[model samples]
Target: MNAQFFGGPYDGLSLATAEVNRYGRVVSKRFKGQRVHFVLLPPLADWERVRAGEVDSAPKHPYELVKTGDNVAFHDADVNERFNEILRAPEEA
Candidate 1:
């Protein structure tokens, strides 16, 4: 299957690609082909994956993408929390 880039609920955000590893790990997966981009997932997105057993990684791994952009790849503990602030509110609630 060809990977899809994520456009947030109202298209306020997007990702270059999503990669699911052979081990079942998932994130806003990146490839070298993408330039001047960012990979960020909703706070609930990773937790939902956890609930569904989609990711086989540690707790912080999901938000790893949010902590850094293309030029920097460092992990910051509060990345998820910070990202949640920018997500568009659901139209219904």
Candidate 2:
């Protein structure tokens, strides 16, 4: 589930993956930021509930649940900005 940022300045913040559970459910997603990298684990039973639509509350972030594609992407305008910033920054030489 490794993903590369295909566009924007902070393209280096790429190669992310979702952690899976024993049942092959995605339990978390990880991404690297300019100053920090983060792992966002699904809330307790969040995957089951999201799939079932049993919970009334909507997910705060957009996520993709697809099965028929070579690549799937999830992005928002803010994410695009962040990525661009990360890519354009000067690197240590």
Candidate 3:
């Protein structure tokens, strides 16, 4: 699936699964009824670095993209707790 992102660092980007993983992971799948949330995070560089502890993959900005089907919405969220919660959440199987 491809989602269009607006606001934050990834603004104006329309990315696929592979491209999206470069910035952050899909923390939520159908989180709020057909909506997928992608947390905006710090530069990860690569998975090797992520496993090497060389990159901090934490939320860099209070921004995330919520995609519902083909439509995507960007939010500048202030709730850190929610970000952390979703960050640790497993994608729905």
Best candidate according to lDDT: 3
Q: What lDDT would each prediction earn against the true structure?
A: 0.33, 0.36, 0.56
13-49 in candidate 2: lDDT tens per residue?
A: 3333552222122323223432422222234346466
lDDT for model 1, please: 0.33
Model 2 residue runs over 4 Å out of place are 1-45, 62-70, 75-93
Question: Which stretches of model 1 miss by more than 4 angstroms?
Answer: 1-55, 58-70, 75-80, 88-93
Model 3: CA > 4 A from native: 28-36, 43-59, 78-93
In each prediction, how many residue pairs overlap at the backbone (N, C-alpha, C within less than 3 A)? 0, 6, 0
- Which prediction has more favorable lDDT, 1 or 3? 3
lDDT of 3: 0.56
The weakest ten consecutive residues by lDDT in model 1 span 29-38
Itemize residue pairs with steric clashes in candidate 3.
Answer: none
